[model samples]
Target chain A: MTITITAFERSPDGGQGLARDTRVRWALEEVGQPYEVRLVSFTAMKEPAHLALHPFGQIPTFEEGDLALFETGAIVFHIAQRHAGLLPDDANARARAITWMFAALSTVEPPILELGSARFLESDKSWSAQRMPLVKDRVRDRLTQLSARLGDADWLDGPFSAGDLMMVSVLLRLKASGLLDEYPNLSAYVARGEARPAYKRAFEAQLAVNKPPAG
Target chain B: MTITITAFERSPDGGQGLARDTRVRWALEEVGQPYEVRLVSFTAMKEPAHLALHPFGQIPTFEEGDLALFETGAIVFHIAQRHAGLLPDDANARARAITWMFAALSTVEPPILELGSARFLESDKSWSAQRMPLVKDRVRDRLTQLSARLGDADWLDGPFSAGDLMMVSVLLRLKASGLLDEYPNLSAYVARGEARPAYKRAFEAQLAVNKPPAG
Candidate 1:
């Protein structure tokens, strides 16, 4: 079924692919499944219409025919499950890959998200500086173990799967913070995910929406 | 295969069933699956051995023979996938249930966890009071929509699946804040989750570990 997903009318990151729709778009592209995008404004997000699709009022809700899905991890997980390229065939390895997806979002991403919340929503707070390092450290500590486990390997576990898709997505948020550069292997890992033709297609798709209007 | 899961030797919450392991334990109980728990002290948790199981230095790692998984969501998902009753049979409903799991962790849980971090880790800061309300409002916003969607329903979708298990676990974190009471439906919903025999069993099990040593 051809899918239609929502995106931030304009991502705060200026088309850097922080909008999770990039991951969904990338997954669709990887499986060579064409889809449509529905850009949502901030005002529209708080309304019941958008909340119906995403209870949290977030972007990148996926809909196709009778099925509607929210939560980027779940959407991407569904995409990976339905599509061929995003998951592996081996049962155990596939489970491990799925574990990585959870690890990326549940473990690694939480602190990074905390950092973002501190910077944007709590920047005026006097403790931003003090609190930020602790948050960053938590992210780095997780990254350190992850990087060590990864070593010089290209992907997280075996081959490219939804795990890598998610891990790379989590790491990208740290790029602006300069913390990701601390781990060369992770930087290269992010690079490999970006280099994927599918990732490129997805990035371009999100960029198209968030890119500045014509001169 | 029999599974062995790691839990806090002494849960910080004194096990009022707030530990992540409680969710896993409840899932096991719900599935009528007997499992083992391996308690790890804080020191052991940070050591290399435990770190291998959980990079974030946390408890509730699941091991079923050769298979090892971290992240409560992944472990719970694995259990639900392998066993019956934790997931819906209908494909669309199953997808939506899984989506709620992601929504619980990525969207709803993050802010709640942040509120925890802010209280425990950053409470000394002067701006904590100022930042807390903003963070709380974000959480309330999510709960309002979730409660609206749930509305007098017994469970999230059709049945008592892993989605409600996850959503309830996330909401439990906010129970003490009285923010949950603001949405009476959500407060009642959490009570429903707690009232489950599986949940009671899980909570009591964790509480045993949380209680202080014999005097």
Candidate 2:
């Protein structure tokens, strides 16, 4: 059966890889997996049909035969497991890569998301100005630790695997916030991820969909 | 070789699983892994020895033979991959579980952490009261979707797996906030996780370590 994924008919970021689906699409593209995308509007996302596949009713649900999956981490992991390119060959290295994957989502991503939510969703609130700094500081705290550990490395762990992919994706959320610029190495790290032909393809694809209706 | 983990000698939570060590302990217990805990005073955590193992200068770093790992998600995942119980045998089911782990950390946990940050770190600020409701609403929105999906279900996915462990851990963060009570199913769902024997062992073990600082 053909692998199929649902993506926003138009992403809020206007095709920026910040959209969750872009991560899955990029992962598939990296693995050279030919697939189809089912575009979904924001309204359709909340409808029962989309909700059936994704309980939270979000974009980027993966379906292959009887298998249906949500959560970009899981989808990327599935692709990595099924196709060899995204994972390392050695068992220890593979385990380490997987560890980085979890680290990306669990440890690093939390503060970044907070920074974004505070800036975007709460910007209109009375506390936005005060809250933004606290949130950004938390993000910086995580990044300081992560950057120290990553210290002069091309990727988070040894070599780029799904770990780096997910980390870069999470970090991209802060692109507009200018906080990422505080860490020169982290900025270059994201550039490296975006430079990948696979990521470029994914970026362009998502961009094509959201290129309309300028907001 | 026996695995060793670092934890707070006197936890701020007074042994409540709010401490990161609790998650690591729960994962170790779930995997039937024999491990020893090394208690670190707050000062020691900032020192080089602890910082070398965990860049964040936090507790619950794992060291076994040559391998040193931090981040609860990474540690729990390492435990699950090495052991049999926490992951599924089926390829797709395993992917779904892993997805929940990511969702727990990335999607659900961020807002709760924001709540924590708002309540503790920023509580003294001039805008604390004004900022809280905005943060609470975000947490509630995430809970609403998650609770709706998890309605009438025992776990986040099929049976119980590491996914549930992570999801429960994420939900536990909001227990004291009373915001969790806004979603009855999620509150009950957290209660169900707390009732597990393994969870009991994990919670009590951490609680014992930080028991009132000898008061």
Candidate 3:
């Protein structure tokens, strides 16, 4: 069955590859799966058709034959489960890898997202400047623990798996914030993820769609 | 091998069952698995010993023989996969069920957690009063979409799978905020989850541990 997924018609990040479709794309690339992308405009995303695919009206819904999935973590995990490269063969190792995937989305990403809201959504508010530090500190606290755990490790656990894929994608959001730089090991860790051939392919794929017309 | 999980020595919710451990316990109960709980104080959670089991330094962690796992989503999922009951037998349905689990933790829970931060962590801030509406509205936006998707359905998807288990757990957090009541179907959905025999057992178990000493 041909796998089909959705991507933002024009990503808000303007091709930085922070959009979630990049994560799915990276997973597919890692697994050597070729898939098709359907672009959805911001307006159309809220329309009945797209909403049917993703109730939350988000981009990056996955469809393979009769199976449809929306959450990025799920999409990546599904791809990982179907393919060999993304998960370990050992039962315990695979469970630990999946744990890292949850940790990335559930524990680590929330604070970074709060920082995004403070900078973009609430920037014009009277208290934005005053509250920025608190939001950033919360992100730092999670990163501190993550950095300590990482401790110069190349990937989160044993050889790059979906866990590292998800965690690196989540941490990439903080690249512009410079908070990731505070933990040099994490910064290097993110760099190693970026250095992957699969990641580079995925990044360029999304960038090609979102990049501006040259003069 | 014996299954053991960790919980708070004293839950901040005072046994209302909002803690993530309750989610794990509920999954175990649904699958009819008996497990032991190890309560950890806040200080010990951050110490080296506990951090070895849970890198993020939060409860609960799951341990069985040599295998250990953390992150409630992963732990509950681990139980669901090992035992029958929490997931569907069909492959597509199981994938969709896992998607809901991710949606619960990644999409729905984050805004609710932000509401937690706004109410508890930032309540003393100068901007608390003025900024709360934004936080509340963000949560409402997600709930509105969720309510629309749920419609008259008893669960988010077919049957009462892990997806419902997780979505219900995520929505339970909003009960105190009064946001859940805005959508009757969602409110009913959560009530249905709470009404489950497994849920009741899990809730009572946590309550027993966290309940204050009687006079």
Tens digit of lDDT per residue, candidate 2, span A95-165? 77877787788778878777777667777887677567667778888888888878899986677899899
Query: Candidate 3 lDDT, tens digit per residue, B155-187?
Result: 878999988999999999999999988999999
Using DockQ, give the best candidate's number: 3
lDDT of 1 by residue, A19-57 (tens): 888888888888889998889999999898998888777
> Runs in model 1 with CA error above 4 Å?
B213-215
Candidate 3 residue runs with Cα over 4 Å from true position: none
Candidate with the larger DockQ of 1 and 2: 1
lDDT of each: 0.87, 0.85, 0.95
Candidate 2 CAPRI-style tier: medium
Better of 2 and 3 by DockQ: 3
The DockQ scores of all candidates, in the order shown, are 0.73, 0.68, 0.94
Return the candidate ranking by TM-score, descending: 3, 1, 2
Best by TM-score: 3
The candidate, 1 or 2, that scores higher on lDDT is 1
Task: Judge candidate 1 at residue A46 and give its lDDT.
Answer: 86
